[model samples]
Target: PEKRKIISRFGAFHGSTIMGAALSGLPHMHKSFNLPPLPVIFAARPFHYLDGLPGEAEHDYATRLAQELEALILAEGPETIAAMIAEPVMGAGGVLVPPEGYFPKVQAVLRKYDILMLSDEVVCGFGRTGNWFGSQTFGMEPDMLSVAKGLSSGHLPIGGVIISDKVYQCVADEAHKVGVFGHGFTYSGHPVTAAVAAEAIRIYREIDLVSQARRLGDYLHAALADALNDHTLVGEVRGRGFIAGIQIVEDRATRRAFAPELRIGTDVERRCREHGVMIRNMGDVLAICPPYVIAPKEIDYMVDGIRAALDETAAEHLRTGQLA
Candidate 1:
């Protein structure tokens, strides 16, 4: 049998196409659609802030997750498993960054089972995490990784996959047998999109984009910590480089979140827009992924606006007696 089972994680958002939707593990992405489950198995999300055991060390948590993955692969039969796909820093999963040693442990598990590791770099690619790819920052040795969004800096929309030499050899051998690989979408390589992506790469090289993102990322995370780390409603502020996530909670002590009807994330997003910053809100997590070229002043403005939004939202809850 062809290797078919691929491992993804809960709270993941791979893409919106049929196969991508099947790859995704979020309900919102599957809204209004009745698609059957593909051969994708969902593993645990690396949400240490929420899911970590009380007082558990980060390294131990990573080991536990790796053991869990191994259990899945064993039960499913490793030979039937093709690859385990993951975002280096889970973007749609509220920018969830795994425990410090998580990827290496997970990669070890994959190696034990002879399963491939695939990095979904759509959101964390191209200096988002202060590196050319989040995989580099996190030390994930992926057999293949997908790239988009930053490929053309959202200017024209293009994506490509890079494969390891082993995978390439297999592909080349198969293509030799068939004359050419017959895998593609109608717009697989639109000339204009390719040109735009090429230009984006050139500009990135010209400006030393990676180092710039690394420096600015440090400042952005520091600013966010200074502003919101101790806020009453903020459960967590996390990210690297130009990306971040603010976890909102009704009670910071127990990490209790507001009810779904509150739409607290959406309110923060609206307020942020009013104050001239844009944030992507997914339920209670407010995500910020500013452009790599953002100045320190812009980071300040964005963080300030989010703080105000949280304050306003908290005040409303207080008035309604939903918060104490």
Candidate 2:
């Protein structure tokens, strides 16, 4: 088998185990263990809210990114490139959503080069993105789909890859040649976890959870937009379905981020926790990914909590000379 390159986006959080951490693009994970041993290539993440240039339309941004990908593959030699992995919504990477036409264009580039496309749906699968899978939401048809997180609704630890027929057949033939398949975790197919996942799938289908997530996601987005859009420190509000992010900045007009020493996101997160709400903060962005079972009232509460936290943090900043 020829060596293959695995291309990943910056700030992505695939996992924390050795190989998983290496695959992750966030520097925090690498601080403890220098990683990405040899095969991984880092690429720019398509976060429209933060990285899209001024006056650039979403479609153009996507096109430019796709072209950049093609250039990278050519430079690295496509034959050596094994796969390009991505999250349809870029979850732990601050809920970074791709610009319009981004996934489709990237998929086209991958196909042109015959490189495998791996959709890492760990955080965007199973109704989190208003669809059964983020690939459906983003129009990506991948060779392999890695799913986790909502697979069991956080009820159990389980993850697996859905390999396409072509890849499956190749692996099968290769295994026969080698007399062993040779790749599996100790708990790769644990029955208990599978049973929990089975039940979770049943509930999602029985209740039409995908549609519900879509509906509630709309409510969540509107509520957050209404509450935080005008805040002085909010740079942008972006996300899909139940997963969303409010990017905090020192200058909202210029989208200038606050100093790292300020730790504004941390303060906001602490305040949200004080208000009985949990939110994940990445740099200056505050992310909210509530459970699918939450009701409209709970949605209101979540928004209110975020609002209160932001307001309080802003007030504190003003008092301390951190904000003008």
Candidate 3:
């Protein structure tokens, strides 16, 4: 049977295409684009910070998420589901880093239902996630992994899919029977892009940037925790490696996000830029994804800038009587 339904999680940002938008669970993208309706199922995101229940341990949270996934797959009829696509670290969806055992348990459920696990490594690939791929960082054994963005280190736009031997064999046999495999884009194999990507891969190995990201990530996370964990507006500080998010909240004790109209995230982002650092905000969560080559002093500078920006933004709000 041709399994056409692919499962995604809430808050995921795959891309901006008809098919990609359909696979993504963000409502703004879907409504704005008038995305073509496609067969896509949504499962709960394993965001421990926001999604985990009170008194729930990390492993327990993982177990609960896995159970929810199993339930979703069963309800949808596992056979009809072709694949479950995920990012090792949820980037645009608020830098959601899954619990320690989350991926392994989720993969076990997918295996029982004969569903393929697809890893979208566009953001977490090429040393951004402290590993060659986020799959390695998170213990995900994906049947196929899609990577881009970091392939040419954002120097060239080239994306590709890596498939396991079993899947490749099936595809090869099908193409053989059909006499021609009709697929892919005109820029798929452009020599310039290929050359640039190849050189980038070589540089990654030569400098061992993955290890550097891992080491620097520890510094970044720790610095962020020390500086902002006790702040009134900070609800959570979470992430791994170079990809991270700082959740801004109206009520820190309750972890209630600031309303979109307040534009807290955008305001903080502007403040960071004014302080000589640039970051993006998804609603009230500020995302930080720095270069793999960033030095310790640079990390300090960026984190410091963010701290100052937060303070400035808070002061401005207080002065204007906008903060409650």
> TM-scores across all candidates?
0.97, 0.97, 0.97
TM-score of model 3 relative to the true fold? 0.97
* lDDT score of residue 311 within candidate 3: 91
Task: Provide the global lDDT of candidate 2 against the true structure.
Answer: 0.89
What residue pairs are clashing in model 2? 5-82
Least accurate 10 contiguous residues by lDDT in model 2: 30-39
Residues 1-324 of candidate 1: C-alpha lDDT, one tens digit per residue: 478999999998889888898888897777778888689888999999889999999999999999999998889889899999999998888989889899999999999878899999999899989889999999999999999999998998788999999999999999999999979999988999999999999999999999999899899999999999998889999998888899998889898888899787888788778888788998889988888777899788888988888888788878988876
Can you write out model 2's per-residue Cα lDDT over 1-324, one digit (the tens) per residue? 464689998988888788778778998888877565668888889977778889999999999999999999899988899998899888778888889999999999998888888999998999888889999999999999998878898999998889999999999999999999999888988999999999999998999998899999999999988998899989889889878988999997787899999999999999999999998998788988988889999989989998999999999999999896
Q: lDDT score, residue 249, model 1?
A: 89
Give all candidate RMSDs, comma-separated: 1.2, 1.2, 1.2
Question: What C-alpha lDDT, on a 0 to 100 scale, does residue 191 get in candidate 1?
Answer: 93
